[model samples]
Target: MGHRGFKSSQTQRGLAMVELVITLPLLLLLLFTFGEFGRMLFQYNSLMQASRDAGRFVAGQAWNATLGKVDLSATLQSQTKSVAVYGIPANPNGYPAVVPGLTTGNVSVAAVGTDHVQVSITYTFVPVIGSALPAFYGQSVPLGLALTSTVVMRAL
Candidate 1:
């Protein structure tokens, strides 16, 4: 017997509700964290693939059989940057970047060791939560993390 001559089950009717109220927020937070982590990984994978594609493009174009070395010309560099961002040698109008906030300036193409071509891409990942977080010290913390992907391929 419990309050008002009712059984214990009746008195504990709201117990589950109280527990759920307490734990729901934590569960939702964990779910969102996992989702954001997955999104970040997806973006990083896209960046890496773009870098590899650009590296392959440059490697194929920079190799000179007669010179026996890699020659990265200005036009080739521009096209490589375009390829990293748009997956093509030419940037078509209204084409979206491979990853959000990616641009031609973020891509760099270089000749490595005179025999290899290196394509590097730098991107700043902005979380879905916010671009910046408030710190305890009254300063704003940047949530955007810089991610760099580099691919080197032998010129041929």
Candidate 2:
């Protein structure tokens, strides 16, 4: 008559362990997916910033008096590529690239009109987490993502 509570059996010892084993991988997958998406967004923004800067620089040039067109020098083009890749026109060694396979050659500079300049940049985004958990899931994810940014600006 002292106590009438039901007592738990030894069979319940592994219930908590089984639940954790089943749910832990799912929880980890959700967490990593969010992180990977954030990483992709950051890389894309960096590309846009680089292209806008290059386009701005080119668009600011004055039209040539003799040529009657907004003349561009090779030096300016070279500097544009340098700035797009390394984030600085004068920096030789790249400061850790945001995209995995980005290069100076991937940046293109072109004149769209008499007063407009366009800068295009391409990058490949590979997720570090997506490829690591292939065994946990049955499906294989994409190898990488291709990202491009183009900026066109009119001369001032």
Point to the candidate with the largest lDDT.
Answer: 1
lDDT per residue, candidate 2, 34-138, as tens digits? 998998999899999888877777676634657767777888778878777777766756476545668888999887778777889988778884433354568
Question: TM-score: which candidate is best?
Answer: 1
Model 2 local distance difference test score: 0.78
* Candidate 2 residue 18 C-alpha distance from true site, Å: 0.7
How high is the lDDT of residue 113 in model 1?
91
Give the C-alpha miss distance for residue 89 in model 1, angstroms. Answer: 0.5
Models, CA RMSD each: 2.8, 3.8
Q: Residue 150's C-alpha lDDT in candidate 2?
A: 97
Q: Candidate 2: which stretches are off by over 4 Å?
A: 1-9, 92-100, 129-141
**C-alpha RMSD (angstroms) for model 2:** 3.8
Give all candidates' CA lDDT scores: 0.92, 0.78
Q: Please provide, for model 1 over 14-130, each residue's C-alpha lDDT reduced to its tens digit, 9 standing for 90 to 100.
A: 999999999999999999989988999999999999999999899889998888889888999999999999999997686899998899999999888979999999999999989
